[model samples]
Target chain A: MSFHEKSNLAVLALLTLVFGVYFLWLMPQMAVADPLPPPAAVAGVLIPFVLCLVVLIGVVHLVFKLRDLKEKGEADERDRLIETRAEARAGFMLALGVFGALTLLLAGAAPFWIANALLGALVLAELVKGVLRAIAYRRS
Target chain B: MGKGKTRIANSIREQRFHAGEMTQQQLADAVGVTRQTVIAMEQGRYSPSLEVAFRVARVFGKPLEEVFSYEDEA
Candidate 1:
Protein backbone atom coordinates (compact mmCIF):
# COMPACT_ATOMS: atom_id res chain seq x y z
CA MET A 1 0.00 0.00 0.00
CA SER A 2 1.08 3.58 -0.56
CA PHE A 3 2.27 5.60 2.39
CA HIS A 4 -0.70 7.95 2.19
CA GLU A 5 -3.08 4.99 2.13
CA LYS A 6 -1.37 3.48 5.13
CA SER A 7 -1.57 6.80 6.94
CA ASN A 8 -5.27 7.13 6.18
CA LEU A 9 -5.93 3.62 7.48
CA ALA A 10 -4.03 4.31 10.65
CA VAL A 11 -5.98 7.51 11.27
CA LEU A 12 -9.31 5.81 10.63
CA ALA A 13 -8.38 2.99 12.96
CA LEU A 14 -7.29 5.38 15.67
CA LEU A 15 -10.44 7.50 15.41
CA THR A 16 -12.64 4.40 15.52
CA LEU A 17 -10.88 2.87 18.46
CA VAL A 18 -10.69 5.99 20.55
CA PHE A 19 -14.28 7.14 19.99
CA GLY A 20 -15.67 3.61 20.11
CA VAL A 21 -14.07 3.04 23.47
CA TYR A 22 -15.31 6.38 24.76
CA PHE A 23 -18.89 5.66 23.73
CA LEU A 24 -18.78 2.26 25.37
CA TRP A 25 -17.54 3.81 28.60
CA LEU A 26 -20.22 6.48 28.44
CA MET A 27 -23.10 4.12 27.77
CA PRO A 28 -23.84 3.15 31.37
CA GLN A 29 -23.40 6.70 32.61
CA MET A 30 -25.78 7.93 29.95
CA ALA A 31 -28.46 5.61 31.31
CA VAL A 32 -28.12 6.97 34.84
CA ALA A 33 -31.07 8.54 36.72
CA ASP A 34 -32.37 12.02 35.86
CA PRO A 35 -30.39 15.26 36.07
CA LEU A 36 -27.94 13.88 33.57
CA PRO A 37 -24.24 14.03 34.36
CA PRO A 38 -22.46 17.14 33.17
CA PRO A 39 -20.92 16.45 29.80
CA ALA A 40 -17.58 17.64 31.16
CA ALA A 41 -17.70 15.41 34.21
CA VAL A 42 -18.57 12.41 32.15
CA ALA A 43 -16.28 12.68 29.12
CA GLY A 44 -14.44 15.95 28.80
CA VAL A 45 -11.12 15.01 30.39
CA LEU A 46 -11.05 11.49 29.03
CA ILE A 47 -11.85 12.62 25.52
CA PRO A 48 -8.91 14.98 25.28
CA PHE A 49 -6.53 12.52 26.92
CA VAL A 50 -7.42 9.69 24.56
CA LEU A 51 -7.39 11.95 21.54
CA CYS A 52 -3.90 13.17 22.42
CA LEU A 53 -2.66 9.63 22.78
CA VAL A 54 -4.08 8.60 19.43
CA VAL A 55 -2.66 11.65 17.69
CA LEU A 56 0.71 10.98 19.18
CA ILE A 57 0.72 7.45 17.89
CA GLY A 58 -0.20 8.62 14.41
CA VAL A 59 2.49 11.25 14.37
CA VAL A 60 5.10 8.76 15.53
CA HIS A 61 4.10 6.29 12.84
CA LEU A 62 4.28 8.96 10.17
CA VAL A 63 7.67 10.13 11.36
CA PHE A 64 9.08 6.62 11.17
CA LYS A 65 7.53 6.03 7.76
CA LEU A 66 9.04 9.23 6.45
CA ARG A 67 12.42 8.30 7.82
CA ASP A 68 12.27 4.87 6.23
CA LEU A 69 11.29 6.28 2.88
CA LYS A 70 13.26 9.46 2.61
CA GLU A 71 12.16 9.99 -0.96
CA LYS A 72 8.51 9.21 -0.38
CA GLY A 73 7.46 11.70 -3.07
CA GLU A 74 4.80 12.91 -0.69
CA ALA A 75 1.41 14.20 -1.91
CA ASP A 76 1.68 15.30 -5.49
CA GLU A 77 -1.04 16.97 -7.53
CA ARG A 78 -3.31 13.98 -7.92
CA ASP A 79 -3.09 13.08 -4.25
CA ARG A 80 -3.87 16.63 -3.23
CA LEU A 81 -6.82 16.78 -5.61
CA ILE A 82 -8.27 13.54 -4.29
CA GLU A 83 -7.91 14.67 -0.69
CA THR A 84 -9.53 18.03 -1.41
CA ARG A 85 -12.51 16.37 -3.01
CA ALA A 86 -12.91 13.95 -0.15
CA GLU A 87 -12.76 16.70 2.46
CA ALA A 88 -15.33 18.75 0.55
CA ARG A 89 -17.72 15.80 0.65
CA ALA A 90 -17.07 15.25 4.32
CA GLY A 91 -17.64 18.94 5.05
CA PHE A 92 -21.07 18.80 3.44
CA MET A 93 -22.03 15.85 5.65
CA LEU A 94 -20.77 17.67 8.74
CA ALA A 95 -22.85 20.74 7.95
CA LEU A 96 -25.97 18.63 7.52
CA GLY A 97 -25.24 16.82 10.76
CA VAL A 98 -24.83 20.00 12.75
CA PHE A 99 -28.03 21.40 11.27
CA GLY A 100 -29.86 18.23 12.29
CA ALA A 101 -28.50 18.56 15.80
CA LEU A 102 -29.72 22.15 15.95
CA THR A 103 -33.15 21.07 14.80
CA LEU A 104 -33.31 18.48 17.56
CA LEU A 105 -32.36 21.08 20.13
CA LEU A 106 -34.99 23.48 18.85
CA ALA A 107 -37.54 20.67 19.13
CA GLY A 108 -36.72 20.37 22.87
CA ALA A 109 -34.41 17.35 23.05
CA ALA A 110 -32.25 17.13 26.19
CA PRO A 111 -28.85 18.77 26.15
CA PHE A 112 -27.36 15.33 26.57
CA TRP A 113 -28.98 14.17 23.38
CA ILE A 114 -27.86 17.25 21.53
CA ALA A 115 -24.27 16.78 22.61
CA ASN A 116 -24.25 13.11 21.71
CA ALA A 117 -25.83 13.88 18.38
CA LEU A 118 -23.12 16.37 17.61
CA LEU A 119 -20.41 13.94 18.57
CA GLY A 120 -21.99 11.22 16.49
CA ALA A 121 -22.17 13.55 13.53
CA LEU A 122 -18.53 14.53 13.92
CA VAL A 123 -17.42 10.91 14.07
CA LEU A 124 -19.52 9.98 11.08
CA ALA A 125 -18.12 12.87 9.11
CA GLU A 126 -14.56 11.90 9.85
CA LEU A 127 -15.27 8.28 9.08
CA VAL A 128 -16.83 9.22 5.78
CA LYS A 129 -13.83 11.40 4.96
CA GLY A 130 -11.40 8.62 5.74
CA VAL A 131 -13.32 6.02 3.79
CA LEU A 132 -13.62 8.30 0.79
CA ARG A 133 -9.90 8.95 0.90
CA ALA A 134 -9.16 5.24 0.91
CA ILE A 135 -11.50 4.70 -1.99
CA ALA A 136 -9.87 7.51 -3.94
CA TYR A 137 -6.46 6.02 -3.37
CA ARG A 138 -7.51 2.59 -4.49
CA ARG A 139 -9.65 3.58 -7.46
CA SER A 140 -8.04 6.77 -8.66
CA MET B 1 -14.09 14.71 -11.17
CA GLY B 2 -16.25 11.75 -12.00
CA LYS B 3 -15.18 8.29 -10.84
CA GLY B 4 -15.00 4.69 -12.18
CA LYS B 5 -14.06 5.57 -15.74
CA THR B 6 -11.41 7.52 -17.62
CA ARG B 7 -11.10 9.01 -21.11
CA ILE B 8 -7.29 9.00 -21.19
CA ALA B 9 -4.97 6.07 -21.73
CA ASN B 10 -1.19 6.11 -21.57
CA SER B 11 1.86 4.03 -22.50
CA ILE B 12 3.87 5.11 -19.46
CA ARG B 13 4.76 1.51 -18.68
CA GLU B 14 6.28 0.87 -22.06
CA GLN B 15 8.08 4.15 -22.00
CA ARG B 16 9.48 3.43 -18.57
CA PHE B 17 10.62 0.04 -19.78
CA HIS B 18 12.44 1.60 -22.73
CA ALA B 19 14.07 4.19 -20.50
CA GLY B 20 16.59 1.82 -18.90
CA GLU B 21 13.88 -0.23 -17.21
CA MET B 22 12.95 2.77 -15.08
CA THR B 23 11.07 2.09 -11.88
CA GLN B 24 7.79 3.75 -11.09
CA GLN B 25 9.31 5.47 -8.08
CA GLN B 26 12.00 7.04 -10.21
CA LEU B 27 9.57 8.20 -12.83
CA ALA B 28 7.29 9.62 -10.13
CA ASP B 29 10.18 11.57 -8.69
CA ALA B 30 11.09 12.93 -12.08
CA VAL B 31 7.51 13.83 -12.81
CA GLY B 32 6.67 15.14 -9.33
CA VAL B 33 4.08 12.51 -8.44
CA THR B 34 3.76 9.48 -6.19
CA ARG B 35 4.69 6.06 -7.52
CA GLN B 36 1.05 5.06 -7.09
CA THR B 37 0.02 7.93 -9.37
CA VAL B 38 2.36 6.64 -12.05
CA ILE B 39 0.94 3.14 -11.59
CA ALA B 40 -2.60 4.45 -11.96
CA MET B 41 -1.71 6.29 -15.12
CA GLU B 42 -0.08 3.21 -16.58
CA GLN B 43 -3.16 1.10 -15.83
CA GLY B 44 -5.52 3.70 -17.33
CA ARG B 45 -7.37 3.92 -14.04
CA TYR B 46 -6.68 7.62 -13.28
CA SER B 47 -6.25 10.44 -15.67
CA PRO B 48 -3.56 12.98 -14.88
CA SER B 49 -4.08 16.73 -15.11
CA LEU B 50 -2.75 18.60 -18.10
CA GLU B 51 0.16 19.85 -16.05
CA VAL B 52 1.06 16.38 -14.80
CA ALA B 53 0.55 14.93 -18.24
CA PHE B 54 2.97 17.44 -19.69
CA ARG B 55 5.43 16.75 -16.89
CA VAL B 56 5.30 13.00 -17.57
CA ALA B 57 5.87 13.55 -21.27
CA ARG B 58 8.72 15.89 -20.52
CA VAL B 59 10.26 13.29 -18.22
CA PHE B 60 10.14 10.77 -21.04
CA GLY B 61 11.53 13.33 -23.51
CA LYS B 62 8.42 12.91 -25.67
CA PRO B 63 5.39 14.90 -26.73
CA LEU B 64 2.24 14.83 -24.61
CA GLU B 65 0.18 13.14 -27.33
CA GLU B 66 2.87 10.48 -27.71
CA VAL B 67 2.49 9.51 -24.06
CA PHE B 68 -1.28 9.79 -23.62
CA SER B 69 -4.30 9.55 -25.93
CA TYR B 70 -7.89 10.67 -25.60
CA GLU B 71 -10.69 8.15 -26.15
CA ASP B 72 -14.02 9.89 -26.40
CA GLU B 73 -16.84 7.87 -24.89
CA ALA B 74 -19.51 9.99 -26.56
Candidate 2:
Protein backbone atom coordinates (compact mmCIF):
# COMPACT_ATOMS: atom_id res chain seq x y z
CA MET A 1 0.00 0.00 0.00
CA SER A 2 1.09 3.55 -0.61
CA PHE A 3 1.51 5.98 2.27
CA HIS A 4 -1.90 7.50 1.59
CA GLU A 5 -3.57 4.10 1.56
CA LYS A 6 -1.90 3.15 4.80
CA SER A 7 -2.96 6.46 6.32
CA ASN A 8 -6.51 5.97 5.13
CA LEU A 9 -6.67 2.51 6.68
CA ALA A 10 -5.38 3.82 9.97
CA VAL A 11 -7.97 6.62 10.05
CA LEU A 12 -10.76 4.25 9.08
CA ALA A 13 -9.85 1.90 11.88
CA LEU A 14 -9.64 4.79 14.34
CA LEU A 15 -13.02 6.25 13.38
CA THR A 16 -14.64 2.83 13.64
CA LEU A 17 -13.26 2.16 17.07
CA VAL A 18 -13.85 5.61 18.54
CA PHE A 19 -17.34 6.20 17.18
CA GLY A 20 -18.31 2.58 17.70
CA VAL A 21 -17.62 2.89 21.40
CA TYR A 22 -19.38 6.24 21.60
CA PHE A 23 -22.60 5.07 19.97
CA LEU A 24 -22.61 1.89 22.00
CA TRP A 25 -22.46 3.90 25.20
CA LEU A 26 -24.90 6.56 24.07
CA MET A 27 -27.56 4.33 22.51
CA PRO A 28 -28.56 2.60 25.74
CA GLN A 29 -28.95 5.90 27.56
CA MET A 30 -31.26 7.25 24.87
CA ALA A 31 -34.03 4.81 25.78
CA VAL A 32 -34.13 5.20 29.58
CA ALA A 33 -33.07 8.77 30.29
CA ASP A 34 -36.13 10.89 31.08
CA PRO A 35 -36.11 14.33 29.46
CA LEU A 36 -33.04 13.06 27.57
CA PRO A 37 -29.51 14.10 28.36
CA PRO A 38 -28.73 17.77 28.39
CA PRO A 39 -26.39 19.22 25.78
CA ALA A 40 -23.81 19.70 28.52
CA ALA A 41 -24.08 16.03 29.42
CA VAL A 42 -23.63 15.04 25.77
CA ALA A 43 -20.72 17.42 25.61
CA GLY A 44 -19.19 15.57 28.52
CA VAL A 45 -18.83 12.57 26.26
CA LEU A 46 -18.35 14.52 23.03
CA ILE A 47 -15.59 16.75 24.29
CA PRO A 48 -13.52 13.75 25.23
CA PHE A 49 -14.44 12.00 22.01
CA VAL A 50 -13.26 14.91 19.90
CA LEU A 51 -10.10 15.24 21.93
CA CYS A 52 -9.24 11.58 21.59
CA LEU A 53 -9.95 11.58 17.86
CA VAL A 54 -7.78 14.60 17.20
CA VAL A 55 -4.93 13.30 19.36
CA LEU A 56 -5.03 9.83 17.87
CA ILE A 57 -5.13 11.06 14.29
CA GLY A 58 -2.17 13.29 15.02
CA VAL A 59 -0.27 10.36 16.48
CA VAL A 60 -1.10 8.18 13.51
CA HIS A 61 0.26 10.74 11.06
CA LEU A 62 3.29 11.31 13.24
CA VAL A 63 4.09 7.62 13.17
CA PHE A 64 3.63 7.48 9.43
CA LYS A 65 5.91 10.46 8.97
CA LEU A 66 8.54 8.92 11.18
CA ARG A 67 8.41 5.73 9.19
CA ASP A 68 8.86 7.55 5.92
CA LEU A 69 11.00 10.55 6.65
CA LYS A 70 11.93 11.10 3.04
CA GLU A 71 8.35 11.30 1.86
CA LYS A 72 7.32 14.89 1.24
CA GLY A 73 3.63 14.16 1.84
CA GLU A 74 2.69 15.73 -1.47
CA ALA A 75 -0.30 14.13 -3.14
CA ASP A 76 0.13 13.31 -6.81
CA GLU A 77 -2.53 13.44 -9.50
CA ARG A 78 -3.77 9.90 -8.89
CA ASP A 79 -4.23 10.53 -5.19
CA ARG A 80 -6.16 13.71 -5.87
CA LEU A 81 -8.40 11.93 -8.37
CA ILE A 82 -9.15 9.09 -6.00
CA GLU A 83 -9.92 11.51 -3.16
CA THR A 84 -12.15 13.62 -5.39
CA ARG A 85 -14.16 10.62 -6.47
CA ALA A 86 -14.53 9.40 -2.91
CA GLU A 87 -15.61 12.83 -1.69
CA ALA A 88 -18.20 13.07 -4.46
CA ARG A 89 -19.85 9.87 -3.28
CA ALA A 90 -19.51 10.79 0.36
CA GLY A 91 -21.27 14.07 -0.36
CA PHE A 92 -24.42 12.14 -1.20
CA MET A 93 -24.10 10.19 2.01
CA LEU A 94 -23.91 13.43 4.00
CA ALA A 95 -26.94 14.79 2.22
CA LEU A 96 -28.91 11.69 3.05
CA GLY A 97 -27.80 11.89 6.65
CA VAL A 98 -28.82 15.51 6.88
CA PHE A 99 -32.19 14.62 5.39
CA GLY A 100 -32.64 11.98 8.03
CA ALA A 101 -31.77 14.45 10.74
CA LEU A 102 -34.28 16.89 9.33
CA THR A 103 -36.90 14.19 9.25
CA LEU A 104 -36.24 13.46 12.91
CA LEU A 105 -36.76 17.14 13.66
CA LEU A 106 -40.09 17.18 11.80
CA ALA A 107 -41.28 14.15 13.75
CA GLY A 108 -40.88 15.88 17.15
CA ALA A 109 -37.82 13.88 18.14
CA ALA A 110 -35.74 15.16 21.03
CA PRO A 111 -32.98 17.63 20.26
CA PHE A 112 -30.54 15.07 21.63
CA TRP A 113 -31.67 12.51 19.11
CA ILE A 114 -31.56 14.99 16.24
CA ALA A 115 -28.06 16.12 17.17
CA ASN A 116 -26.80 12.58 17.44
CA ALA A 117 -28.41 11.76 14.10
CA LEU A 118 -26.53 14.59 12.45
CA LEU A 119 -23.29 13.51 14.09
CA GLY A 120 -23.91 9.97 12.97
CA ALA A 121 -24.43 11.18 9.45
CA LEU A 122 -21.18 13.06 9.43
CA VAL A 123 -19.24 10.14 10.82
CA LEU A 124 -20.87 7.72 8.43
CA ALA A 125 -20.06 9.94 5.50
CA GLU A 126 -16.41 10.06 6.55
CA LEU A 127 -16.32 6.27 6.97
CA VAL A 128 -17.82 5.78 3.54
CA LYS A 129 -15.25 8.10 2.02
CA GLY A 130 -12.45 6.17 3.67
CA VAL A 131 -13.81 2.85 2.45
CA LEU A 132 -14.25 4.17 -1.09
CA ARG A 133 -10.68 5.49 -1.06
CA ALA A 134 -9.35 2.15 0.11
CA ILE A 135 -11.25 0.31 -2.58
CA ALA A 136 -10.07 2.68 -5.27
CA TYR A 137 -6.50 2.12 -4.14
CA ARG A 138 -6.88 -1.66 -4.14
CA ARG A 139 -8.67 -1.95 -7.47
CA SER A 140 -6.80 0.71 -9.36
CA MET B 1 -25.04 5.30 -18.82
CA GLY B 2 -23.35 2.16 -17.56
CA LYS B 3 -19.63 2.40 -17.04
CA GLY B 4 -17.28 -0.10 -18.62
CA LYS B 5 -14.00 -1.31 -17.18
CA THR B 6 -10.90 0.56 -18.33
CA ARG B 7 -9.73 -0.77 -21.68
CA ILE B 8 -6.52 1.22 -21.91
CA ALA B 9 -3.48 -1.03 -22.11
CA ASN B 10 0.14 -0.12 -21.57
CA SER B 11 3.53 -1.75 -22.00
CA ILE B 12 5.21 -0.04 -19.06
CA ARG B 13 6.67 -3.30 -17.84
CA GLU B 14 8.19 -4.05 -21.24
CA GLN B 15 9.46 -0.52 -21.59
CA ARG B 16 10.92 -0.61 -18.09
CA PHE B 17 12.75 -3.79 -19.09
CA HIS B 18 14.10 -2.06 -22.17
CA ALA B 19 15.15 0.92 -20.10
CA GLY B 20 17.74 -0.95 -18.04
CA GLU B 21 15.22 -2.62 -15.77
CA MET B 22 13.91 0.66 -14.41
CA THR B 23 12.09 0.35 -11.08
CA GLN B 24 8.50 1.34 -10.68
CA GLN B 25 9.61 3.91 -8.15
CA GLN B 26 12.00 5.40 -10.71
CA LEU B 27 9.31 5.70 -13.36
CA ALA B 28 6.86 7.15 -10.87
CA ASP B 29 9.43 9.68 -9.73
CA ALA B 30 10.28 10.63 -13.26
CA VAL B 31 6.62 10.99 -14.17
CA GLY B 32 5.56 12.77 -10.94
CA VAL B 33 3.25 10.01 -9.69
CA THR B 34 3.19 7.40 -7.00
CA ARG B 35 4.73 3.97 -7.45
CA GLN B 36 1.29 2.42 -6.93
CA THR B 37 0.08 4.47 -9.89
CA VAL B 38 2.86 2.97 -11.95
CA ILE B 39 1.89 -0.50 -10.76
CA ALA B 40 -1.76 0.15 -11.59
CA MET B 41 -0.84 1.25 -15.10
CA GLU B 42 1.36 -1.82 -15.65
CA GLN B 43 -1.47 -4.11 -14.53
CA GLY B 44 -4.03 -2.24 -16.67
CA ARG B 45 -6.18 -1.50 -13.63
CA TYR B 46 -6.04 2.29 -14.10
CA SER B 47 -5.99 4.71 -16.96
CA PRO B 48 -3.77 7.74 -16.54
CA SER B 49 -4.52 11.24 -17.73
CA LEU B 50 -3.15 12.38 -21.07
CA GLU B 51 -0.46 14.46 -19.36
CA VAL B 52 0.73 11.52 -17.26
CA ALA B 53 0.65 9.23 -20.26
CA PHE B 54 2.81 11.66 -22.17
CA ARG B 55 5.16 11.99 -19.24
CA VAL B 56 5.59 8.23 -18.96
CA ALA B 57 6.34 7.88 -22.65
CA ARG B 58 8.79 10.73 -22.50
CA VAL B 59 10.70 9.02 -19.69
CA PHE B 60 11.20 5.92 -21.89
CA GLY B 61 11.95 7.97 -25.02
CA LYS B 62 9.01 6.33 -26.84
CA PRO B 63 6.00 7.69 -28.63
CA LEU B 64 2.79 7.88 -26.58
CA GLU B 65 1.07 5.40 -28.90
CA GLU B 66 3.97 2.99 -28.50
CA VAL B 67 3.57 3.03 -24.72
CA PHE B 68 -0.24 3.00 -24.40
CA SER B 69 -3.08 1.78 -26.59
CA TYR B 70 -6.87 1.66 -26.36
CA GLU B 71 -9.03 -1.33 -27.28
CA ASP B 72 -12.57 -1.06 -28.58
CA GLU B 73 -15.07 -2.87 -26.40
CA ALA B 74 -17.35 -3.32 -29.38
Which DockQ-derived CAPRI band holds candidate 2? medium
lDDT, candidate 2, equals 0.88
TM-score of chain B of each: 0.89, 0.90
Instruction: Give the distance in Å from residue B48's predicted Cα in candidate 2 to where it truly belongs.
Output: 0.4
Residue-level lDDT of model 1, residues A1-140, one tens digit each, is 66777778788887777778666675456647488766676576457857775776678686758777664637877778888999999998899889999999899987777787787789889989999999888888
Model 1 residue A139 lDDT score: 85
Candidate 2 Cα RMSD after full superposition onto the native fold (Å):
2.1
List the DockQ of the predictions in order. 0.64, 0.51
Q: Which candidate has the top score in DockQ? A: 1
Mind giving the per-residue lDDT tens digits that candidate 2 earns over B1-74? Answer: 01234788889999999999999999999999889889888888788999999999999999999999999888
Q: Please give, for residues B6-27, the per-residue lDDT of candidate 1 as tens digits.
A: 8787889999988999999899
lDDT (0 to 1) per candidate: 0.81, 0.88
